[model samples]
Target: MTASGALDAPAASRPMPSLAAFTQRLRDRLIMQEDPATAAYDRIMRRLGISIGIAGIIVGGVELPEVAEQGRYAPAWWTVAAVVLAFGWYPIIAVVSAVSGPRAIRFVCGCAAMSFLGALASIPFGLKLHTVDATTVWPFRVTALAVTAAVLAWTSRVTVVYLLTAATSAALATVYTVSAVTPQHVTENFLRSAGLAALFVWCGTAATGAAARVDRESAIASRRAASQAAAHSRDRERARFAALIHDAVLSTLLEASRAGTKSDVLQRQAERTLEQLDECRGAQRDPDLLDARSAVLFLRAAVHEINPSIRFATRTWPGYDDLRMPVHSASTIAAALTEAVRNSLRHAAVPGREVRRTVTATVSAGSIRIVFTDDGAGFDLAAVSADRLGISMSILGRMRQLAGGSAFVESQRGEGTTVTLVWGGDGSR
Candidate 1:
């Protein structure tokens, strides 16, 4: 069957897709062709880094006085510079890294490495001026925790090495700076520094790793489901071809054999059968394009099939019905519209609240525009999970893949949702 015919099929006649198959298709349609879960994890980690970086800045600012008092031990300017680089500059870099592209990961990692090296140079890691007191808190130690978290933008293995190196360096520096070094002191200092850094690193690593694993498994499952779908489509096509041959070719040949060669009726039947066969071959080779009228009708039928209750309206300008577009473009628009209506029905229809859904299709100036609107319970777009493919894949992604096609979804809690799909104006093929 043609794409349009499939859409026009009665809802009851169409077999419902299994839950696993539906889930697989949704995962496969994610906007990112690469690891989508990994991408989401990166975004989350970047935000977390920014938060930690900012917190470090605030903590450093509060400890500026204590940090300044250490001026007698280290050069005054050097002390202040270390504090600024570790707290102020580090967080600023984190903010930039979060907002920037992939290249920013290296930049952030470099910044973290510099901060660690600077801390090493200022050895003693926040030592008082020749004081033997072990009760003093190291301000740089707090900054180290945030920096370690930022380093997570790199590979986990690299981050682990950096954490160990920084922690060991801080411990040795503490031992050297104190007047009296003891085994207990060394172990305590090392554990203190490593513990803080490890906490941050572990959280980031666990979250990102889980995301990557989910993406990998989703990809595998989606591929398996796709293979099954292909097999089903092939089986259906084979059955259809068998029936066609039996009903048309066999009947025509039987009629011809029974009637003699002189029968004009048999000749006409045979010619008609040949023409039908040729048309079937042509359909297999190339899908038929839809004219503007046919496209509008197809979309109307599709919306009705999905939801018979929706109010569908169509507007056409002069010469609109004469325009023609590729079959794929028309089917894509229909599919996107179908998803929009489904979303409205599924999410917008709140109990005890009356909901009204409408679809408008406008064909004019060689372009097609469809808008699905619902006066029902809306939702917060930001609250939607990144992995959710309802709007991103079913609506936006499908339209984006079509030439000269675009989609927009707007919604607000307690308000309503409006989805607009457009295709074929400029840049159309």
Candidate 2:
């Protein structure tokens, strides 16, 4: 499926009412969250292209002295212009590739093609130098070409195509440079350029492999998180249903046992049983329009399920439970709150002692705040790894997706950790 379709599919399949459905809703929210993959790719490509382009100008500078010193060799103009044009074109192409949606890879390959031509254009100069100063090598003129090839390799997935191009360029440059000066030493020049080209292409190949691995791992992680959330939601709903049934049916049975065969008591018990059954059936109806109190209850139940022992410290201002927000916003807050509590349970502990943590939900007129605080050992926020998706992706990212929402983390080593999520629906308030 396309990315958009994949994101919407989960939400469409499960309408929010049951805990499982809300969990799926949060999972869908996360899936719909903006991915950094595009921006990251663009930044790397732009940097590579601009850096290489600058290097090209410098390499061309080295050749200018040769062209000027050679008197009026008309062919020198072609080589010099080609060198300038090849380098000057890169930054433009890189910018275009970054902005161009599906054509980025193709644009990058075009750079490789241009780079090869730039190197080949230096052949006239190489020939001219051979006629003037036959003993000196002209390898420096081709340095721009090698650098361009490396940049292309870094961005392109088809490493074989780049390697083939690099190999062909090395062979051509070697043959031309050697034939222009000394045919007898062609073998030595070929080996040197070919070896360097091989090394460069090998590095490019390694880069391609590493990028592919990272992309694959990111996809796997996203899929796993979605699946786990769906399953967890289902389990929570099942437990809720079981509890409802036990409370309703078992209570009726106990009442009937105590007051057996009293006609009025039996009648009342039967009527109560029917009412409970009706309530149970209605319980599966949509929860998307829930008031603030119901959402808070759901949040409390979710955190309690994660760890039954941790005490909850909650407070609210007047009209706190009566206020309403969008279902998506509510689910996002709950998921983030759950994650914050889980983080505390996992990492909020000193080396030799267990400490209690508390999760608090405070609702005011326009917004709500969920704070998870623990006295257990905490570390520097800057010390956290970029790959830790629990805080970055689950908590901060989820909150940021909401229109008027933010996440805050305050922690210090040997002190404690506090995660605060503050949000006002769609930012209107």
The most accurate candidate by TM-score is 1
RMSD of 1: 11.8
What's the lDDT of the predicted structure labeled candidate 2? 0.56
Clashing residue pairs in candidate 1, if any?
A: none
Model 1 error, position 127 (Å) = 5.7
lDDT measured at residue 311 in model 2 versus the true structure, 0 to 100: 73
What TM-score do all the candidates reach, one by one?
Answer: 0.60, 0.52
Instruction: Please give the TM-score that candidate 1 achieves against the real structure.
Output: 0.60
lDDT of 2 by residue, 1-429 (tens): 000111112322333367844443333222222133432343344445445545555665666665454424336555466555545554555444333322453465466555655655565654543343433334334543554445454544454455455455645554544325455555555555556656655554455456556656644544454444444545655676788678767777787788746768667867887886787686553333335555566667667866888776668899785455555566667677776776666555444456657777788656777777777655457755554456677788889988888998787655667888888765532
Runs of candidate 2 with Cα error greater than 4 angstroms are 1-37, 62-76, 90-109, 118-159, 162-174, 177-184, 208-216, 254-259, 263-273, 285-429
- Model 1 error, position 153 (Å): 3.7
lDDT of 2 at 378: 52
Put down candidate 1 lDDT per residue, 43-92, tens digits, no spaces. 55555556656766677777777666555676666676777656655566
